[model samples]
Target: MARVLEVQGVSKRFLGLKALQGVTLHLEEGEILAVIGPNGAGKSTLLNVISGLLRPDAGRVLFLGRDVTPLPPEARTHLGLGRAFQIPTPLPELTVRENLLVGALFGRPGRSRKEAEAMVEAVLELTGLAAKAEAPAGELTLLEDKRLELARALATGPKVLLLDEVMAGLRPKEAQEAVDLVRRIRDAGVSVLFIEHLMPVVRALADRVVVLDYGEVIAEGPYEQVAREERVREAYLGRRA
Candidate 1:
């Protein structure tokens, strides 16, 4: 499969603290990649750089073989990068469908209102939000809110989706459902790069796993392989005395 997204030698710093150091990773077409790490491993910072929310101190972001390091978040969205926050904050006044319509219309430049609405409908069905389409976004239960977050990002027509701990607050059953939904998203032609703290979710969904420590990649491979690495274990659990 083609490499749809690439972060080469990326680095970020904040007020004299190194948030990321020469981090490099890639997402292939139709692949699901997971980024796992201890707290302050720079996962969020990496996502921000990729999504164009932050300018890296060094390195470049490439999407579809084009350099996009200079693009803004909305510009990157227009170019097929979609993102869902860990927290779901839907517009209180808007209906579920309306919230999705917002993503569809603004995410892709030049998408007509008719086309945007069509995309919204497709996303609602894909994310299983059709039943609650007319309901106010603020009224959704936790699971429904999570679905809406994923649905809104999907409505943007992304070639690659960036997920930040989307499974954070779910129960086991709900997380399993979300795992299935993510698989369907990949099957539907969107490559996924997600940060997840749940090892089960990573093992279930990731084609490859990348481990980070102190903002640097310590290991990268299949889930089980990376899980057994001494460095990874030590990263999660402090080194032996």
Candidate 2:
């Protein structure tokens, strides 16, 4: 598949500190790329820059072969990029159906109310939220909340989905389910770029892994290859010897 998102030599600065330094990466159409890094590695910063939440001090972002680094967040969303937050936040007072409606209304490919509702209903079912549509958003369990967050992002009609730590707070079984949901998202033809700390989940879900440490890519490859790298293991975990 062709490249759907390209980030080249991206950098960001705060005060005198650099959060990212000449980071470059991209995602292929319908591929799942797992990004793993220790804290403060600028993983989230990279995601933000690609999604248009943070502007890069240097470099450019291209979406489907077009420069989009100058575009706003909403414009990116409108152009088939969507993201779920690391922390889940839904409208507590809104019913699952109603909250989903908001995503559908704002993120759908439609220009009218009827189109929005139809799109929302389709995604609600796809994300397994249809059964709980009438349930209040505040009434959901942790896993359910995570799924809802993903569902909302999908409702925005994104072809490239950026997921940050969706499996962070779930139980092992719940984590598996969340992983399954992401697989479904990819199977539906959307590309996935996920940031995660769980080694097993990354091993299971990612076609390839990208390792970041102190804001630079230390390694990139299949899970086993990366996990076996001496320097990568040392960077993430102190060497046994």
Candidate 3:
């Protein structure tokens, strides 16, 4: 598969605090690349930079061979880039289906509302939310909310999905279900770059892993290679990687 997302020599700073330092990474099309790092390791910062929520101080972001460092999040989304948050955000005033409709409408770059609605229905079923189509978005359970977040992003019809710790704070079974959902998403040919602290999930779902520490990539490769790296083990033990 071709490279779908690329971060080269990326750096970000806030006043005197350096949030990221020369961070470079790439996400291939239709692959799951799990990013694991301890607190203060700039994992979330990387996501924000890629999604255009935060501008990096230096370096470039390329999508489909196009320079997108300056593009806004919506522009990127229109080009098949999508992101999910640690906390799912849904419109309390809207029905679950309505929320999905919004995604469907936006997912297609220049598609019509009717087309978006048709697409939304398909996405709802894929995200396992078809049964709650008429339910109020505000009434969803935690699992449903997380699924909704993913559903919203999927509604954008992305080829690449950036997830930020969406698996945290769940029971073992719930976590397993969430992991299964992610795998299913990947199976549908959407590349995933997920920021997760849970090693088991990372091990189970990711074909590759990227380990970051102090804003720089400390290790990158297959799960076993990265998990067994001395530096990775040290980094994990250093700040709980």
Candidate 4:
């Protein structure tokens, strides 16, 4: 499969503390890749760098075979990069459909109102929010809020999507639903790269797993293989893999 995203020796720092150090990974076309690590392992930092929310002090980021290291979040979105935050930050005043419309209209440049509306409708259906299209975003349950976050990202018509711990607060059943939704999104041709702490969700959804510890990658492979690594076990001691 084609490489849709690449991070080469990426590094970041804050007041001499290394948030990320020589980190590297890639997301292949149509694949679901998971980044797992203990808290403060720089997983969110990696996502921020990829989405252009933060610039890396070193190395580069490439998207769709072009270097996007210098691009801002909006520019990256125009180039087929979509991002959903860990915390769902929907506009409280807007309905579900309206919230999605924000992404559709601005995600890419040169889109007409008609095109954006059509995209919003499709995303609402895709993310299982069609029935709640008119509901206020702030009034939805946690599951519904998550769906809206994912839906808003999809409305951008991305070729690659970055999801930051979308299942952090969900129950097991709700997380399963999210896992299925992510698979459907990948099947629809959007490659996914996500940061997740939920091991079950990672096991169920990831085609490949990258383990990060102390701001560096310690293991990268299929779920079963990575789960067996000693460093991964030590880093996540007493936690079932």
Off by over 4 Å in 3: none
- Regions of candidate 2 where Cα sits further than 4 Å from its true position: 108-110, 238-241
lDDT of each: 0.94, 0.88, 0.89, 0.93
What value does the lDDT take at residue 27 in candidate 3? Answer: 90
Clashing pairs in 1: none
Give the C-alpha lDDT of model 2.
Answer: 0.88
On residues 114-181, what C-alpha lDDT tens digit does candidate 3 reach at each position?
88888788888787899999999999998888888888998888889999988887777888988898
**TM-scores, in order shown?**
0.97, 0.95, 0.96, 0.97
For residues 1-241, what per-residue lDDT tens digits would candidate 4 score against the true structure?
7999999999999878899999988999989999999988899999999999999999999999999999999999999999999999999899999999999999999999999999998888778899999999989998999889989999999999999999989999999989989999999989999999999999999999999988899999999999999999998874445
Candidate 1 lDDT tens digits, 109-204: 899999999999889888889999999999999899989998989999999999999999899999999999999999999999999998999999
| Model 1 misplacement above 4 A | 239-241
What is candidate 2's CA lDDT for residue 220?
91
What residue pairs are clashing in model 4?
none
* lDDT tens per residue, model 2, 1-241: 7999888998899888788888888899999999988877889999999999999999999998999999998889988898998987899999988887787777745548777788789888887888899999999988889988888888888899999998997899888888888898899999999999899899999999988877788899999999999879887775225
Please give the distance, in angstroms, between residue 45's alpha carbon in candidate 4 and its true position after superposition.
0.6
Q: lDDT value for candidate 4?
A: 0.93
Pairwise TM-score winner, candidates 2 and 3: 3
Candidate 4 error regions (>4 Å): 238-241
**Clash pairs for candidate 3:** 236-241
lDDT accuracy of residue 38 in candidate 3: 88
